[model samples]
Target: MSDLLARHRAVMPNWLALYYQDPIEIVSGKGNRVVDAAGKSYLDFFAGILTNMIGYDVAEVREAVERQLATGVVHTSTVYLLRGQIELAEKIARLSGIPDAKVFFTNSGTEANETALLLATYARKSDQVLAMRQSYHGRSFGAISVTSNRSWKNNSLSPLNVHFLHGADRHLTQFKGLSDAGYIAACVDDLRHVLATAVAGDVAALIAEPIQGVGGFTMAPDGLFAAYQEVLAAEGILFISDEVQTGWGRTGSAFFGIQNHGVTPDMMTFAKGLGNGFAVGGVVARGDLMDAPHAVGLATFGGNPIAMAAANATLDFVLSHDLQANAARTGAIILDGLRAAAPRFPIVGDVRGKGLMFAIELVDPETGAPAPALAARYMEETRSLGLLAGKGGLYGHAMRMAPPLTLTEDEAREGLAILVTALENIS
Candidate 1:
């Protein structure tokens, strides 16, 4: 191990995972690529875990931060009214698609989900929440409580009583063999059964990721959440869409992943790409839920001027460039290429995802069992070949790729070539 790695282990928590067997320190980045401390460049398909939406060192975001820095007043608690915060809030509210929507900023997606949970519980007067199985929220206690992935769930105790539901991972699920309509019907029936028999009281809310991020970019069939929404609404249960990984046009077909399901969530949490690598996240909801808590509440450094500026600039860049359309175009090419190559590689059990957020699930060729070791080997091979991808899933058998929305056809094809080569050389 390098000296920095040794020091990192000494100082940081052992649970914080890092990629690569010989982890390289990424010192700088430009466009879609990053340079390590050893000056090795890699095409950053992970994009800082999908946080750098527009790409590294984006000029607009940098200038926005610089302009805010010029003001010399970066940190202002939520007590004071700040122009940048107000402007950004207005932008988010308009784009949120909720009537009379209000926004509350946080420093990260975990905090955003935390705030959402508080609102859901307080509004509905219940501590019982429903979460999807094979889902990942965040690392914080409250976030982890709802997380269904065993590897990410560090503890069993939780403030809220969370019931795990099906429908997140279609391929690895019992609904795998069913047709699209059959799958949706079965999942809906299961949800109805859970609510009827299991939940003791009125359920507070149903929180779900439109696309399971840390669960390896797994997505449920279309209209699955819409089906759940109908059931939840009948029981007065709030719908909370955790858009941390699928928000801001990353999914291509829709501005928010939940939109693809054809239902408007009562509350939505966003982070990761919103600030373009800056620490910014927030919850957007109707006015009633926003004011549900009667007591005083505030996030000390949540809506700081610098973070708001970065987010506003990032949103502007995303819109002006029509990156959502770009994502749809480039993502289709990459997805088609991968699907075409999957037949040649028997280890690839599935190729799935929308837009730039895609994954390839590795499985044992003969038995069709989850092949996590093969996935790990493929990751290491890709790293050595100057490509960076992400891994996740309950079995750690899925290779995740979520490049910047600005990915060109050439870059997408290049990365695809490397990925194919990595798979070919896996044996």
Candidate 2:
């Protein structure tokens, strides 16, 4: 092991996962690429697990952060009035689409999800909830309780009695044979059955990811959540969209990933892409539900000045540049190319994506089972050839790719070529 990596292993927890067999020490980044400690520059397709939304070394965000730091008041906490916080709240609330929406800032997606669950259960007065299989919300105590995927969950004991619903995984699920309409009906039926038989009283909410990010970019039919929201509305159970990965036009189809489902959720939690590279996350909900809690809640570092400044600059850059449109147009090129080339790559089982978020599932040629080893090999090969990709899935066999929304057509083509070459070598 390298000296730094050895020191990291000595100090860090064993549970903290690292990518690649021998991890690359990233030193600096610019535009859509990053350079390692060894001076090897590479195209970053995954964008630091989709957090670096606009790309690296963005002058807009960097300058905003520098300007804020120059003032020297970095940590006033939530007790004081922070202008950056208020502006960001207003912007997010306006874009949230919920009528009379309010915002609560948190330090990360896990905290955002925890806040959503707190509001949900407090308003409904229930400790029960519904979640989808293969869905990954966050890593908080409450967030993990609602998360159904074993791959993402480390603890089985949960405070809330979470009812896991079947619907999300399309490639290897039992309902894989069903068409879109049939799949939706089946999943909705499962939701109904869970509500009727499993629970005794009210369910606080049904929290879900539009596209299960850490579960390997798996998603249900476009309208599956819309159908679930209908059933949930009847019983007054809230629907929370965990848009940490799918929000902020990352999906290419809409600003929020849930918009494609044709329904408005009662609450939405977001984090990953909003701050670009800085740490920012929050929950947006209707005013009434947001006001349900009588007790005071405080996130000590939730809306810190630096994070807010970074988020504001990133949001401004994204909107002013029309990055959403670019994501659609550029992402289409990558997805279409991958699908067309799939015919020649036999070990590749699937090529799926929406907007900039996409995945390629690796499987054994003979058995068609998940080949996580092959996926790891592919990542190493790609890294060796000046590209960086990410890995996830229920079985750790899916190569997750979420380049910056600001990726140029040329960048997309270059990254796509590197990916194809990697796949070819692996196959």
Candidate 3:
């Protein structure tokens, strides 16, 4: 362990951090699994937080990348015309059903989101950005400001004028006099009022994670988008869907996350599965919103040939394999299994998600309150038993599982069995 620590410390910066590091250096990955330096393997349910869509080291992606590398033109910024970049943008535009949409590539989700933020701010000329609580956009200044996660805001570097929408708050209280639609309407109304009063003339855009992935993968009540769209359209505010975590086929749907809601955002950002495990992120915008005020975005490595190749091949693989249908089918199995097993355990509070992106919330057996401790215990135990699980939700009480869409029914069943056993141990 000391040797591993010393090696990493000497070669890598301290900024590389996420979950626990057991000094087990990850050396390789294949379909739905990863191996550490010690050569032990674990099924990857998180999919690198939903990035490895077609699974790790897919042969098609590798072949495409290799072909591009052999061509020698790797780092041509948007300045010079690049065929791979043009081809990728055209393909994404066609598949997204937004033919008039323009694509801007970036290095990661944060950069893609940053591009969207700048475009929104310039196009609307507004300082105020509205976002929903428990929503995650990205970690950069503009994206962080618009992201409703308090931890991101509490960190001192955040800029001002980013307002919380309070959409998730109303659900915490019981819906006494209102139906679910009414409750959703009320949330939109609150936003309308906020735009009128707090935003006044400073409203730039309303940014939301269409399905709110890290926010418990919460699906908004029906008719939520129609109401919100009415408010934003009236206020001349651009609606940007931060699909960084929910794009591709993760939601068992095509295009952006907003597609599931049947509403078109003025602009949407995508990362993660867009390039599978490759390093790429992109922002697509409505034709009118494509007009940038000035030269605000010019990423040197944005539309590199290698990344474009990987993304093109990835899109092809997703369509050819019909992975979206698989995600929906397998997701149903996981959800149903959880529902059936919940009665057997006092800790399972709720199981909710769409398609491959799902989470099981743990709660106190007596009070039914969020149980972060139990979640932590379950994750620790699962790892020891050879299963890698992820923790999420605002309270860190939901066990998030977003495996590769290619995960088989038997593999999913095996994972659920491990989860059931983990719960049994806790009980």
Q: Which candidate leads in lDDT?
A: 1
Give the poorly placed runs of model 1, Cα more than 4 Å off.
none
Per-candidate Cα RMSD to the true structure, in Å, reads: 1.0, 1.1, 2.3
* Cα lDDT computed for each candidate against the true fold: 0.91, 0.90, 0.79
TM-score of each: 0.98, 0.98, 0.93
| Model 2 segments more than 4 A misplaced | none
Cα lDDT, model 2, residue 289: 97
Error of 2 at 219 (Å): 0.6
lDDT of 2 at 419: 86
- Model 1 agreement with the true structure over 188-299: per-residue lDDT tens digits: 9999999988999788998999999989888888899999999999999999999999999998999999999998899999999989899999999998999879899988
Pairs of residues at least 3 apart in sequence or in different chains that clash in candidate 3: none
292-406 per-residue lDDT for model 3 (tens digits)? 6666557799878888899999988888998888888887888888888889888988887787888888999999889999888888777666677677778888888888989
User: What overall lDDT, based on C-alpha atoms, would model 1 receive against the true structure?
Assistant: 0.91
